[model samples]
Target: MDQQGNDGWILVETLGDAPTVIAEGTRQRQCRPLGNVYRGRTLALVAGTIASVQASRQPARVLLGETVNGIGLVVARPVLGPGGDVLAVQVFTAPADRSPPAPHRAAGWEWNLSASAGPRRTRWTQEFRKLYGVSDTRPPHAYFGLADLYRRVPRISDIAVLMERVDNARPGESLSGELIARRDDGTLRLVRFVRRAVDTPEGVTLRGVDHDITDRTDAGELAVRIMDSDVAATVHSVAGVHAALVDSYHGYAIKWITAPLPGLSAEVEGGQVSLLHGDDLGAVRPHEPARLPGVARVSMADGSWAPHAVRAFPVPGYGSTPVVMVTFSAARPEQHSQHVGRGRCAVPDCQLA
Candidate 1:
């Protein structure tokens, strides 16, 4: 996935490798370095994902950083040998929404305003009942008043406005709006509604439908922030790794920072994976922040290790990824000289457990 799926799926390949993490890339495109095994610039994200697949040997899905009013994600499936060992990984990416959203039938409702009597009556479809997790025990022809309707969609704070809309609506007129609905289980959903007015034997009635748009709305909001130039783009586009962390002693919440931000901020279903470093991570704690200011072996643009000084600090953020921040810097001459000939243990390109 190019730009870690920020640019959508590009080239796909299959290869073999050891448990040891190594990076090599000789070219650049779309604001990122391209490596045969991994193009995800965020070390924490790439390192975490690869290490996860290598351990579980199962396919994993992860967010591909941020996008403009859209979402990016990649599904990495492990290629296994006959003996059941992971040989390589194949990743499929979605940089933009390429598929139509799944459909959800809008729940239907009917309001009869002709009743000059005590209260107007409204009839609702089974779809509406089920949408709010309401158990319908009444006959199909039953009628419910405005009070009952308000109780069902408690999250619609503007209940009075809704009733007024129906009351003032004229025959042959139509209206549309968005509302927040809450189910019996305490789950909240975003619903888009449409209403049309027509005359009937009973009286002028308003026909309405409520369709669920929660998933689409949520994804769109996330995409906008990610693609926003001032928000997540800086982390992804800047030099060195910019990672998000939950707290000290935890794994990377998402830290590609290579292109500049954590690409795997939205982790897999089970839990988040921490960066592979040990005590160094502890040093990043907010309460007693400290910088080792030592040299670490980073994965170079040409797929090699280069000495760099590590600088980290905490900052506020949003989404599934945690708060706290970390940035990497080039090592000073003395610090670089001190770690000139260290072994694999000294490498800090994010090694996962």
Candidate 2:
């Protein structure tokens, strides 16, 4: 099916080696440039298309593809040869950035309040009332007044600053931040608040959702503190890539690492992960890494390779990917088991097993 469905027609077709564009269809608006050689820029998307079909033995859906012009979502199906090998792929582009966000209904509470002020009158979903322990039998205002509501939020010390941000929020854009609140039970809890500005009949109104994030926040902080002892300890993405660098002993976050042990610093900055080599940063290809700890070759500022004993540990709220922490300290003896084959081996006259 094309972006508009099967009624829209096909796009392009090509065959194996000395591979030439055997057929081209309509919708030449952003079609591939003529000629048949595989271009590196679009290689990842094409590979994904073929892989999807081969894996399922049927049509598979992929959200987005990296095209010559930019990224696009497309439906890809394979054209099989007599031997059942994939001969070619037929790709149909889909609408980009046109889909509405999936509605939130499973958890949390929703509220529609007057946009200009603390809600003059507000409506709440049943889920909302249950979440904050609001009484459904009583009138909304009787349960909580605007002033009482403000008192519930313990972190709004600077009311003016927060109000400024809320007032300046653009329509449909979510303004999110964290706050500590004392619920009806008198227990302090951390919550994540998401407020979106919506234009309604009365004027601009604020549509909000609140999700309890106390558990996730507490777990993350505890994990960060526990790993803060290594000289350059960090919380890493599941791929054994650093997500954050920490002052482990002090249980504090470190922002700048102007000087770090040689090669490792180049790969991380400000508790965020990025590729070490700047020149190779243009496009991203889908990848899955091995879960086991191994020796990773990190290219230094001067282009020399340094081996690090990279390890990953699963931590909650880091998504499906585990929190990986790595070390380049030479004080610990290198283990032959850590040798990996992908990069140059740092051990003298040692070949990866």
Candidate 3:
């Protein structure tokens, strides 16, 4: 019941009773038997049984084999009958090496500006406009698609940078600085812009205010010096009073009281008596005897009078909080004269003759 073909061979069925081999190929010995077989059977009987089983049972082809070099491989698929019943099987043997399918290409470009709340139908283009002050009359699709802000207005670059800085800033943090830029109207301006970022569901939105601070800067400096010198002098004029000036919350205020300077004033008494008290004192203390509000009633400088001076503007941004008493003393006549020229003391009596 034995026969020889390329790598090996086999007899069919009982050899004496089974049909002859119909399909034969090279490397038959490498083909492994997959189904059950009777014990002590000849190779020819084994082949015949396998053929009958495959034909009658109609099992789908399940190739289990290896290359002549012994590299393993398996290939399986359903066998179909005339009515798609899968009457029998057909199998092929090959090496395991096989090429894979081609790689996939991208479908198309997509812009994901989807909103999570409010209207679901809102387009990203429209949202971009509302977020950045862009007008709706302009085309939406074309605007974002072409980055129109960057293209149509060159100054938008500065805006973008400022907004980015704001977005990164923390709460209560602000950016105050001068930026020179050409406006949409094509005119250039030195603008002081302050930006603050707010976190919102839509994203980080920057709220900014632009101001022309050129004139304000100059005026503010002058006002500050005038206020400091005048307040310091008023505190100095009171005899026996010691005075000192210090910056408080970026503005100025005065603290003074009457005190006895017996020997000090006498040393220069006849030298030249500069009337330290008069209309200038009246201006600060409009009352016959000036006294400061909210100061201690006790006259630390003099038993005859309490410390007093005019009320001052609250330190900018500091509200009504009173500054700490840095100390008090007499102001030099030259200093008082300088303040008078600065327009701090307009009262005729406070004016030095």
Clashes of each: 17, 2, 15
User: Model 2, stretches more than 4 Å misplaced?
Assistant: 1-119, 135-137, 140-145, 158-161, 217-353
Compare candidates 2 and 3 on TM-score and give the better one: 2
Residues 1-353 of candidate 2 have per-residue lDDT tens digits of 12331222232322223222222232222223323323464455655665677556476555654435343554665544322334334544435553322222112222234434422333444445555554335553232233223334433222223454654555665555555555656455555554556565656555554544454446445333323222222221212333222222211112221124434332232222231233221111112243233344445555555554443222222122222222332322234224222322221233111
Q: Which candidate tops lDDT?
A: 1
The best-first sequence of candidates by TM-score reads: 1, 2, 3
- Put down candidate 1 lDDT per residue, 17-136, tens digits, no spaces: 223211111111221223433544443455566667778989777765575233465555554432344434434444535532223433556777674532455666666677777664
lDDT (0 to 1) per candidate = 0.44, 0.37, 0.29
10 residues in a row with least lDDT, candidate 2: 279-288
lDDT of 2: 0.37
Where's the lowest-lDDT run of ten residues in candidate 1?
21-30
Tens-digit lDDT track for model 3 on 56-83? 6442222234343322232322222112
lDDT of 1 at 58: 92
